[model samples]
Target: MRFRIAAALLTTAAIGLAGCSTGAQASDPNGPLRVAVSPQPHGEILEFVDEELAERAGLDLEIETFSDYNRPNEALTQGELEANYYQHQPFLDEYRTEKGGEFAWVQPVHLEPLAVYSKEHRSLQDLPQGAKVTLSNDPANRLRGLKLLADNGVLRLKPEVSESARVEEAVAENPKNLELSTLSPDQLPRTVEEADAAIVNGNYALKANLKNPVAIESAEGSPYVNGLVTTPQLKDDPRVVKLAELLRSPEVAEFIRQNYTKETVVPAA
Candidate 1:
């Protein structure tokens, strides 16, 4: 309850937003460990920790909730935040590769499965031919959606296509001839009313309160485990290490299990 929540909004038209300070100096070992996170599960989980566990553990946590996918890592890299906790390995890897930052992946906390959801349709097979299928515009996530469709037999990806292949190049066949459209990840859940089907990230779906996805990606062998990230310099800091440890503890895992369905959020093994 003593922790503060800063809301950062990112419009799809303008991704570059002015940075807001967390008032947490990374150089101060005893100061609050500031972390940037997505609003739904990430922010909620951190809130639970800050309220129920952090004080007892001798940790001070300041949680900032970002609606945008790109800004948390940017804030962390710019020294505006001590750490961040919203992205999975693939997304983080892409950001580090493209931005040339040394953010360390501290620990895997949970997996938010990517799922296919629709308002008018009951299943992926129920989707009509030439139906509009919406997906995330971000490259890594776009590929993830494409793969999810391929895995479900709604489409087929080119065997020769690499992870970095263009979305168009990745698709070898569209049996339903579905028209694919890309939008910001936050916009995906809203597409339920407009698009015939949409591949949505779990947190967004949970935010939108969309229950019963037609198809959800399996947690088994999934590489998209959401975790904590910090600068290499602070990777081994006791506070960072402790936070990571608490995130993966049995108590936190039990909280995730109690609060969300396994298909929506699975604690990382």
Candidate 2:
């Protein structure tokens, strides 16, 4: 009878363990979803989402902030991260083409307009001839800078030059004859003192504490907006869908508006 009681006790303990295991599985189907992001406002933005919504959705969002553009994608592709929120579609396409990786943009999250910042000039019109202008040297960003320049009449591109056109494609008719220099996006903010003007990405500009960039890209209907991206396998996953929805939530939208005012970091509808 004591052996039978011992067996019953063992069975009860096994059932309790199974019940706890089942409860944990129900709470976190796949456990926490790890995300990689660029430092500052992007990372900060994620903090808001992670605290306010992700936790409630059973998503344990672990954010690893990167200082440069290259590592986030590398991390995501290597399966070290489940998703990333630091690049535009054009940039992602170029990265995939060059790196031979398999990843896809899950959804458009925000538009961080590329802007021209200067200590000497209040507007692009104030930029004089021979002004030293710094533009991002990466293929994708070079094109974006060129388009912004074209929009401001600083340079002209062929009529057919679409959003994808790069500096080499410019047909410079009456080009401000401005001296253009190329640098990494991260270097643009530091070089602004020497440069009469610099076309800097929104995040870098914000990092350097430069307020109200002289000229911002008009991203009203532009496709060059930034997005949330993930591995191809996770594209259809319900967790990804939920995360995307949270990104577009009212709370995230308000955070973006308050944090990136005049920088135009619009949340995706």
Candidate 3:
């Protein structure tokens, strides 16, 4: 859900701002821009921008962290935040399509590969028949997990199954007869010790210190690069533009390379 990061930890402004702003012009144009983010790479990346780059660039930022995937966009839509950074275009598309809103994806900042992690097994081949496998509960991520399994030859999806296919319609073959289950994305890492395998998002994997994975989604030609998203009016805001530039800057890219492995967090090309 939506929660404030302690001011000391985030180095941000106080979280209790008045609500009711409808768009970019609704809030003080010169005030610190409130941007919502996930705690791992998203928040960390913005923290770099806030502490290192913002002042010099003449931008002020207030960072809000969220645990639930739905909260950032919800807050943004309600004007509690000016913008957000934590989702790919596909996830954003699904959210907009289902929930009905007008939001713009600014630009891709990094790619966090979906991965298969397990504490009970060393490799996918080691998973025994009827092994418990858990995937994140969201539709886009669930389909993504299914694709990751299919890529590894553990399961076979239907020939005609598209990207939007549901979990049931996509699974055409299950050679291991694996017992698949769904859990919240945040819960996947905690289940690693109990389940035979879990297909986890790269951000959550890193947060839980699950750096090494048996298999990971390839970043090359991937459309799932997480980026900045804002309302239509805020898309052209000077502060938003400056922040986007900083997010894709050489320094930010270097920070990503030095701090995160290519497997976990890859700077967008």
Candidate 4:
């Protein structure tokens, strides 16, 4: 009877030890960190860092790519992704306010300047009166394009309008009577021939071979700084903190400089 009791106690201790071991492994610091990214430069840039730096930092980065601008945030908020790297602060702020998503910015990663491109006109000055202009239809980018227009002195906005200003909110003064048309961001390049000019995001511009943008957002003092963001729950996670640091590293900066060229996508260091 005593032998059986001793054996049972030994078995229980072994099981307890095994449970502790499993718990420790589950909480390992070097576990994989899942990150969702938008297609093109954002995902491509993350791949570069994942291959070159993440491993060295004892991090295994799992990248999930999405085609739409809205899915990355949705996936992150749903806890399906650890973090995302596809939006600027303004867009993120708007999303959180409008959708009630609980997320926060980890840090600014890169800046993709919104550029006003034209196939017909070389400069804004050449654009004739009542010329049709194509802007992004998305709520976030519409505001960005409006700000870009305001910056170029093409139109004057109300004094109350800020960087978060949208087309509906704009109070045009001496507007040159330009006819503004909003379209999907992807279609901006395609509409260039039909419209006098189009505001194109940098990624789409790069894909469509429209590199030398006639006018680009001034990166020096621009408010549109792209960033890495995660749910508020994971904000304190060490892996998230490490990834944020890796984003601003020398390696990432060098990669951006070599890959993007000509200050189109500047590192937000």
- Put down candidate 1 lDDT per residue, 167-230, tens digits, no spaces: 7889999989999999998899999899999999999888889888899988889899999999
Error of 3 at 176 (Å): 1.2
Candidate 4: list runs displaced more than 4 Å.
Answer: 1-30, 162-168
Q: What tens digits encode model 2's per-residue C-alpha lDDT throughout 191-268?
A: 889999999887788888877688998877877777789887877777778888888788888888887765746665
For candidate 3, the per-residue lDDT at 61 reads 88
**Model 3 C-alpha lDDT per residue in residues 1-269, reported as the tens digit of each score:** 12336634432332223233345336668678889888889989999888888889888888887766776787777777789999999899989888887898898999999999888788888889999999988878888899889998888998866656667778999999999899999999998888999899989889888867988898988889999999998899898888899999999999999999876899998
- In TM-score terms, which candidate is top? 1
Candidate 1 regions with alpha-carbon error over 4 angstroms = 8-26
Model 4 scores worst on lDDT over the 10 consecutive residues at 1-10
Whole-model lDDT, model 3: 0.84
lDDT of 1 at 176: 93
Ten-residue region with minimum lDDT total, candidate 1: 9-18
Each prediction's RMSD to truth: 3.3, 12.2, 4.0, 12.2
lDDT of 4 by residue, 125-227 (tens): 7788898988988777887787788778888767766545667577466456788888888899888778888998887887777855678887886667788
Please provide TM-scores, in order, for all candidate models, with all chains considered together: 0.91, 0.83, 0.89, 0.85
Q: Looking at model 2, report the run of 10 residues with the lowest lDDT sum.
A: 1-10
Candidate order by lDDT, decreasing, is 1, 3, 4, 2
Residue pairs that clash (backbone atoms under 3 angstroms), model 3: none
